[model samples]
Target: MVHLVKSATVPEYASITGVSLGLKDKVVLGPFEVQFIDVDMYWSRLSFHVNGPDGPKLYVVGQGESFVYPAADNQYLNITLTWIRSDTKTALIEIQSPLQKLLSGQKLNVGDTINLPEGFPQISIKLTSTSDTQATFLVTLPYGETQTLVITEGSGGSVRYKLGDVYSYSNYVYIHLLNTTSDGPATVDIYVPKVASTDFKIVREGEEETAPTTTVETVLVYNDLLYVNEKLPITVDNVTYYVKLVSTIPDVAKVEVFKDDKSLGSIILRVNDDEPKNVPNAPIKLSVQSVEPEYKRAIIRVYGPAGAHVIPILRPANLLVKIDASPKEMLLGDELVVVINVENLGRGDAYDVSVAAPIPNDFELISMTKTWSLKTFPAFTNMPALIYVLKPTKVGEFEIGKAVVTFYDDTSIETNEEKTIYSPVLTGIKVYGIPKIEVNGMAYNGTWGNYVTATLATQSASSSPLKLPMGTRTMNSSRMPRSSSACPAASMAQLRLMLEP
Candidate 1:
């Protein structure tokens, strides 16, 4: 049986409890400070001044009215005037930071690690190094990449990924320290992405369609505002659904939902529907939350089937292969060292891994394995370097093809399917022919000074030497003036000579 768990209607962002303040009184809430600037007796309204990372702003709202603070800022913030005193001398307000949070009751030692969401390992925070009052955290994010964050007590740091939106930090992971000690644990709080998971069954061809699997997990495919005529592509269980707002009439919206670009069906929804409606012939449910007819936009929540929307709760091995060629510029007959590094940054091991290194046409393998395989490579393991040497057979600019790696995902042992990934192509490899030149010079003593004869020769600087037709060469020597103390008769004579090569 499937259970429906409704998401919390409260704002996902953190909020401060209600605070009452009189005129000119200030209260610090998280990273921002709110000051009761003034009161308007005639209008039954109150004025507030807010100062935060986005800078200061003034807001005026009547009792029970709320206004989004930092209107000029990209983040979403809501400040509400919950209540006002009868005499208009003071007001009660609440502040919400839609993109940030302050976590509490988290304590960690120097070598402790914190996994966001408590158990799910999408992002990990490791306290690698620390001092009396400061600590450095190595944050390993998804896709096998890492970032360093250094923070002290009463401060915080965050890692933000690109979601191709104006407010890119909306879903960032944050870490804030509450207290710290040199030899003991540090108190902290962690703020990660707001993710909700649902469960469903994994139906097979021959088995009953109600096979339950507690291992399966689901993700929020789409939860945002969709504008009129805007086609939003949402992928669930490897199949994409194209949802478009056909049009809207007053409080009702006509939506066209398609499965794989093929028309599934059309549906009509009224603004602020209390319950969600299912799309025709699809394992998806959507509800029209609100509509702004003047703006031609609507806020819709899309949910995929519980079990079918699996996100691989079991970690899969992520292999990162890279090639590095040293001495970008080299000469023919010189050896180039090529190093292929393979790292498994995922949480699962890889099996039957094979690597195919590249060798350019103009280059010949000196010594090393161009292709190799491994039975198993564990996760978070940095394999030893696979080194190779090559000698250029021809002189010119060349590039090596990308390396190919094939491996089996340890998480999918039941399927035993093989996955292939390619490394980036190595570029800017230059080679030049050797330069061979010889010079000869002859000198003879003269009456006043010495006369010197020099010769110039030319030859092809290629693997195969080329000869040219014989030609005549000339050498000229100009006479030097007599020494200041020497007599005029002892001056040297000008000399001109001709030679053949």
Candidate 2:
């Protein structure tokens, strides 16, 4: 009955499901929640410190978390830990695709890479390839693994991805890749968020470009074929160029030549280019033998490609060799219009038949419209007569006097050869000035005393009389005077008598 007299003492221990070894501030995980457990707070004699490879262990005590590493000592027993299964399974895949040219008509080869974003510890790319007409590939990216797709063109060349898999936000995904086959020149179009449209262009080696020209002032002059006593002063750009002359004009040129305030000499200027540089300035001379009589036109000849000149025939006066007429002349600085009607009614095809104006001898040929051809017209049509514009200095009406037509064969036919200048049917303008007369408040024609002499009613249009009792004649739209009407309209009657001085 004395058993209670001797009592046994119980030892203090932690009854944890798994043994726990931790530092002072570290919490040890266990199978059950800890309520009150005895822990050896200070047992320095049995403990020794162990330093980690990293500085000062992971013993951090921040705002909400703390970490304390246990000290390694010979007396400390190892505590095994048990892990709990919170997540059963998870999958992640990584995929990458390169750029492609849809129209290249060649094989596509590329290496791709993709970097993972922050929140996704890993992701499955689930890549696919397609073409405008067909699909090229399909693959599910495995977890945490990179899937390499050949991206080769399939039955129908195209590379595409699963629509549902790609999440489109404000920004779209665009892939760009390198191209090795295109001579280092390539461009890829990408659909992305807020980027400027860009186009790339390439420049090849040899290209091209251009350059401009020059002109010189030149002058030509002449007098009749007659000899001159003095050299005419001719200037090229205001600079007197001593040249030999050729002229066929007669009795008009007052030639005087002076060099350095001294008389060089004077002579008839005929022709100049290609003449010898000797003989103290031979005052330009021209020879008729050098000219082809057939051109009826002047001949321009060149010895070099350096651009030459064609000297025109000159007539000093409008009237040259008039049979019974006086010499016709015009003053310097005056202008005149001389019309030469050229009618080419030839039956044969003359390829280059043209009109050549023979300005009276010694006259200066100023300007002209270009020469045209009769060949350009329809068969059997007449050419418009040539009109020569002129100004003269010598007052005389003589005739060198024949309008010539030049043929492409270097031959010419003068007006005399064709007998076309003498017009049998002649016409002149007649004006009338009738005294002011009115018919009862209706003005009959107040502008009278206006020389009133009418054109004789033609015996027939083909023939007209020079004199007739005057009356105003009105022509209808056809140009023949209108048929006699009951009412006489002198207003429409346009007949005026021209006074001869």
Candidate 3:
């Protein structure tokens, strides 16, 4: 109808509809469509649409951008976003194990995963972070097992993860036989940390597995701590022998072998702490063959936990007695002072130390008692002297006999030790007697017939009776008044006759 109807101009406007979705949320499924309709001009346009049982649209959200997606009815959508900033903050991830190279101080960014190398048995690792910032990571193991680990910041940030339970870092004991005989009874000495008890097995070459032998007796030895020294007796078999420990490093034990009881030609065997992985039920084997000289023996050692020590048995004290006599060359009836000294020259203390000094044969005891007692005698020190005074009664050459010292050790066993010391000989004294003499003399004149007066005197100042009588002996001298020349010959003859005895 060409009727004069005026045409109206229509305005065009752009329309946009959006749906928000999170990366962590489930994807939207089912068919959906988006259409554009213009009612003013009766024109419709479908700008974007998605059909079928799939999501309507899928898109990724970049950094600092918002994303939207449609959610199901009556279900609250929970979205978790792990935003990794482009900042220059770095972290260190360290993987610690025995077989792999140490990943120490390895720089890493956020959301980066550290792959550890394959290890024997199974890999177990200790992870450490050396950064002050919190780090979040996802670990995927060899078997596609995944774990989310959050390592906190600072120097104390560390984590230990076990990939499988088939691996172990425990310590084990290996018994090595250097010179041994199969099917023979043997005694083994093992030095270990103090523990309850240990079970082990003895094996030789080419034999079937057998039950283990447990050590029941343990002796404590002194070291840095109380250690257990176990002595085990076992019979060698035809299989490989192994020593297993219930604990690990620092608790390792030692074995020793001696050629004889005197510890000569000895050798020591030990399992080093760095002897690879010490898996349970598997131990290092050290086999030895027969040795030369016919006196060699094997001594096996196994230790327990660390910090155990062994105390040695106490040793008996050694006592030494010494005696000294003053005035060694003394006369009879002289006082002699004899001193007895007791000394302990051993490592241990002596108890009930007693010293006895007996009286000599030719001497008489003047001082109180001859026995001395000491309750305790310290090692390497001397006790007080025991003095004995004696007087020689009748001595030619008398020997002061040994001074005996008897004492017991400070241990509970109470071992006894004794020592004897002999003194020097004492010289005898001499006796002197009074002198005795007899004198016979007579005073005479010229003639024997003539009357004469004579006087006799003794040589000593004190008067003593002579053998000839005390009274004066008179001899007659008839020619005493004769002439001097004639009296000389006669006087000489008379003097000779009167002096004759």
Using lDDT as the measure, name the better of candidate 1 and candidate 2.
1
Badly placed stretches (over 4 Å) of model 2 are 1-333, 372-377, 408-501
Tens digits of per-residue lDDT, candidate 3, 1-501, equal: 011112121111111112222212121211222111111222111111222233454433332332222333311111222232223121111111111112434444332233433321122221222223333333322221223334333211112222123221111111111111222221111111111012223222244544433222221111111112322211122222222111222324333222112221222233322212221321222211111112122222222222223223364577777777777765445688887777777756777777767676667888855447866675668887788788876535566777766666746334344533343433343311122354443333344455655555434322222123345566545524544453334233212112111
Q: Write the per-residue lDDT of candidate 2 for residues 1-501, one digit (tens) a residue.
A: 001111111111111122122322121121111111112323211121223332232222211221223333221112222321113111111111122222232223221113223331122222233333222222111111122222221212112221112211111222222222221222222222211111111111232211101111111123112222213333333334332233334322223345435655543323322231122453323222133223222222111111222233222111111111112333334555555554434322233455555566544566665664443332234566455455554433334345555443112222222211221211121222222222221113334333332332312121222233555443333433234353355553333433211
Off by over 4 Å in 1: 1-313, 369-371, 411-413, 440-450, 453-501
Query: Evaluated with TM-score, which candidate comes out highest?
Result: 1
Error of 1 at 238 (Å): 28
**TM-scores for every predicted model:** 0.30, 0.17, 0.26
Is 1 or 3 the stronger prediction by TM-score?
1
Per-residue lDDT of model 1, residues 87-139, tens digit only = 64667776555643435577877767776664443566777666677767777
Cα TM-score of candidate 3: 0.26
* Quality of model 2 by C-alpha lDDT: 0.27
lDDT of each: 0.64, 0.27, 0.34
